[model samples]
Target: MRWRAGVVAALAVAVLLGACGGGEEPVAATASRTPKPLPISTPTSIQQRCFVPVEGGLTTFTGPEGSTMPGAVLGEGADVAVFLHQTSAAGFCGWATYADWVASKDVKAVLVDLCGWGRSACKGGFAADAEAQVRLLVDWAREHGARRVTVVGASMGGAIALGVGQRAGADALVDLSGPAVWQGVPTAGEAAKETTVPLLLAVAPGDRGMDPPALRAAVKAAPAKHKRFVSTRGSHGWDMLNDGALTEPKWSPLAHDVLAWVKGEYRAG
Candidate 1:
């Protein structure tokens, strides 16, 4: 009986102590403060800054396959169409060095790897390939909502540009160290007579296929009245566009002239 009473008294005391909070000033229950999360910010999409359809990349163009023409897009501005030609297996990014010119001229560039070249799965050769592939480039530009577009090419690319530019009536055409004697064009002179679009043909001083004589013949044949042949100092192909590369930032005289011609701001020659 005494043990049971003792147990009851102990239970009563515990209850009383708990109610009084052990009389230690009753430790205030501090509510944990959870800092409100800072506002999450959203960044602008890269596609907005660069071209939406195509972003910048290395030599190989990772775009669509087959007729899509594997290529990369450079700069954000537009109305200008740039079609790149291959000197070898290198990617079209090599021409990206001219982005400065493309920017200054408010131009957009599409570096193409034609059939059997770069990343293009489509197969064809030179002039024959140009007729079809160049259409793709033109169609791509049109799809992008470009109001005006030009075609720029290097080496064999230049010859292709001439073939397409003449037929397509491109806003302008830029040929950098291209050939005078392509399969169908036969001669730059012949290609020149076919189009009235503003044309700029640039050649390195000692290029094998585009020496001064050939350049003269081509220029003489250009009936645009605004056509010009700029002889520069550098290697062949697109390398001489500006200070030997599209990798270089500054605009060359060649780039300036081409841009001016495209802008319809050049004087008749």
Candidate 2:
């Protein structure tokens, strides 16, 4: 698959930011500007199984046969949320909070430890080779009778998910704190040009390290008929996890919004 050049440029920027010894100023500033309102609904939590093996070694994580991913399941039936963790993070790291949020909306949630990360084997890092692992996960989701798979990826995981959504089939793709382009990774625009699935591009207002302009440019280049951009407050991955203020809202309106979009697309077909 073809990677995005813009993503490469953005990754360079990230590296530069890191080299400058800068803290998360962009994200913090953005968060400060937004109102700290709680979610409208409280979400529940569910646990599930995932298992898959990659080139590095045999995966020992949970999941059904033919899959080796550690994840949790929430909600019921076809309304499912599949969460992909970032690099060096486990499925359970911040899964419960998101799972509970999804469950409150009655949406089943599946949080997976990606290959080479968490309990899964690592053949090569998040390089081009990671694409195979993503493909395997997508295939497993389809085989397991998943009516519709809505993928949410964070950081490196977001990059992987974008690659999968670009070439592999999926219902919807959500990019959280993921750069439009990573080092040798495809930009969301590049992925969008080839992907048929609905795409939601989300960026943290405070992520000065990230170039939202580049991401927006990529979205404009995407081929998907349905594409939307959302701006969230706080650091890249912090807001969605347990430590964030939106961890448990009285009403999980965000989950509902995501599910509504997925269901609309699934039903349209």
Candidate 3:
């Protein structure tokens, strides 16, 4: 679209101007002071805004013309929540564990397709700045009445999630196998240290991508009153969500159980 093309031109200059900078943003075409809202089009697939995971689950989310492919929004209910996938898992569908949990609790889910890769790639097929993509999702949530949002991010998505957790005013955050540092972006550990929201940082001892030592350190430093750390046997991220997988896979029920706790399933009236 012409919109993405214009943004590409601006970002090209910005990328050229900054070499050793953080990747935390996007470039959108300028809008008039009073712009008209894009007409909402009937979605090609209800699966985009429906329950259950499916093959090639990517969906289109409009920006200005109601025709852009921003990402997928899942579930449909009162409690608004957002889920971010890992960089490696982009465009893939493995959130059934978390989605099931949310569905059981009657929560509305916004499953952000980690843009810049796979099926979530930007409209112009150019890489979007990581942080900018996150801000876009969070801002969209805000405008759509997603208050007290809960954020769940894994790996690269976890880092970006932390970068905006407090800014998004999330009530709670869950980080699975997220690294303390990545590609010059501010570490989730740093954000953990500063946030007061309830946080649960889970990591497998053998998780190759996530740094256990730094995660433990950050967890210790986090000032959140309800923060907790779980060292489980599952691989990482959604892999840790496996509670009923084969016995030999080094499985753990951390994902399903912790989510139950974070959403206050354990709280008594």
Candidate 4:
């Protein structure tokens, strides 16, 4: 969940050494640098980076068809938030930062690799088998002491979350840039109509080829009494949860809104 501090230290050494080898007069290495160095904890575009799995936190589950699914769990509590990854090959690692953030709030964070992605390369790939496996996990969580379960997903995983949330009877749902229709599974719009739990539907305008207006409208008209439609300006799916969430290009309120909803503070906006 943290960036490597050695990278910043190495950069600082390079800058200081460069000052010592100056042209006209060798500048003192002890002199102050022009621009301040970035902090060690500064967040980058993590979703685009390759993530090594966290050491020793890995767990496995057996699907109905006997396939093994690997995942990691962070934090522990009666309330659980299950994260499904977007279509990216990075899989559940894409949700690592956000999951850690959720764990800090005392909620159990469940990060799964879905079926074909990450370490769970099953026979059927990302087909109906993946959704079935997620549904099984949801039930598994409930049986294992989760009082309330909220399913959250992005892109392709988002669409699967909607369907799984409905069929699995999750207490709440968060869908980020999920397509209305993905492959041959159930339509997200239809799943949205059937979702009775509190829902948060977030999408960036002009995200890839997604129709934000239609997606927003569908969530707006969903039967869930507590539902919100957020319009953000950022790259699609997992990229929306960035360090510059309050700044331009990432939109001012996207990350905050999602967290608020995650914490059960569902403001009607």
Candidate 5:
């Protein structure tokens, strides 16, 4: 009887161990499973606009082709400077830092959205087809009672300004981080040869995109009567946006230099 009771107890213990092991398998499997999280999307219908006040009333105007390109118009009257948008013609935010500098010298500032970007006519991608767009805007500005028009372009837009200056006969042209030779666009060398307007070229030390040596060579080779080159201590478009505000250096000096240049520092016959 003792041997039989011991056998029964041993068998029961083995059965309990087996049941516990089996139960743990399902728990282990469930713990190993994981569900993925859903992806988030950006909103499409967000309007882009930012307002900053200056000495003069806001200069409101549409884009070249009647499209919505809102910009701030500062300065009292007559004296005007048109700030052309870069590759992305969003607002004048790219040149926002220079607003006060521009306004201080009794010069009106017009920051515009280019045709292809922002709230302009051609949305999504660049509108290289609309080469004459800047010319049209310059013409419109002059028509609206602008006495002396100075065109300022950043990066690709700078190249565009050179062309516009030639076509519209602008008083002065400023090119910030503008390439001397654009891949598909007309080069500054080409424009400079034909342009009678005074030109200011602002190049940053960190401008890898622009061939500084070639640009310098081109400037030397060009046939413009008046031309100047300024080298800064940053990357391309530094004077305009300043690497998305990563650094704290003020860019008003660039505007001051350009304004001074525009104010008869360099004049072409």
Candidate 6:
């Protein structure tokens, strides 16, 4: 009993000393509380770090698999126009100006960065990842009360859009300089054959790595019911967004055609 009392008194003193910061924490205790090195950045953490609320219409959304996808939402119309970027690595930034124009036309213009491009992250092949991620945004727009959703993509993004628009149930699709085949897949031409939504396929004459005529033919043969193939004069991809001279109207011949065509599609739908 006497030894038990002595042990209890010693333990109480030790506790008090520890509480008052008079005792050093054991090595094991200190190591256990070291905060686990803040686990590697997963999709959620990546979103928190890179995807923040931005000014001037910029926003972030979660991908299908939880990646943080950055984009911009311009205007507040129930009809949504989701713009997917090309493979140039410029991401959503490349589509900003054109998207602004689309927004001004009384539509909700959304410029999106595909997975593994821009600030977005994903763990899969580029084509597949892009398709899934973009679909997430389309579904998001519909869930948020969009009456219609149109996916417009350029180059590689355009190829992916050929398939994504149909799969995501988008009201329409615009493929700018998209190839009939991409990344060893018949992403555009074959997908076009199955497209049930309204479609617009535009290409410049000099754009390489794409068979514009074949693509046009494929689109025309598709059962989309509403489709158009606009032939323009320009370089490729984003270059097709502007006229070479950068004149007053500024928009490329293709851009003008796309705008007019899309406007009609929106009105018809």
Off by over 4 Å in 2: 1-67, 123-128, 238-255, 265-269
Q: What are the root-mean-square deviations of the candidates from the true structure over C-alphas?
A: 12.1, 23.8, 19.8, 16.4, 9.8, 9.0
Q: Which candidate ranks first by lDDT, i.e. highest?
A: 4
State TM-scores per candidate: 0.68, 0.64, 0.65, 0.73, 0.67, 0.72
Segments in model 6 whose C-alpha atoms lie over 4 Å from true places: 1-55, 123-127, 244-249, 264-269
Q: Is 2 or 5 the stronger prediction by TM-score?
A: 5
Q: For candidate 1, lDDT tens digit of each residue in 1-269?
A: 99999999999998898887774433433323545689975313222222233235533322333243556666656566676674667545456556435655577767766666654565334324556567667767777877777888888778878766767547788788887777644467778777688788888777775656776677777778577777778777766655642233455666666667655565554
The deviation in Å at residue 145 for candidate 6 is 2.0
lDDT of 2 by residue, 181-243 (tens): 665457666776776677776676667566777776766777778877666655564244334
| Model 2 vs truth, CA RMSD | 23.8
Name the runs in model 4 displaced over 4 angstroms: 1-56, 123-127, 244-252
Q: What is the Å distance of residue 234 in model 4 from its true position? A: 1.9
lDDT of 6 by residue, 144-257 (tens): 888878888888878878866678677888888888787733566678778888888878766766888788788778797788787776677766877533223388656766
Each candidate structure's count of clashing pairs? 4, 30, 3, 0, 1, 0
Best by TM-score: 4
Per-residue CA lDDT of candidate 5, range 121-223, in tens?
A: 5433334543455665667768868787778888877767765565665777888888777644568777766766667777776686776765565556656
Give the local distance difference test score of model 4.
0.73
* TM-score of candidate 3 on Cα atoms, chains taken together: 0.65
Question: What are the lDDT figures for the candidates, one per model?
Answer: 0.64, 0.59, 0.61, 0.73, 0.63, 0.71
User: How does model 5 score by TM-score?
Assistant: 0.67
Candidate 1, residue 189: the lDDT equals 72
Q: Give candidate 6's whole-model lDDT.
A: 0.71
Model 5: lDDT equals 0.63
Comparing 4 and 5 by TM-score, which wins?
A: 4
Q: Candidate 1 regions off by >4 Å?
A: 1-68, 123-128, 184-186, 244-248
Q: How do the residues 92-157 of candidate 3 rate in per-residue lDDT, one tens digit apiece? A: 345544555565566666765565544454544223455455555657766777645667777766
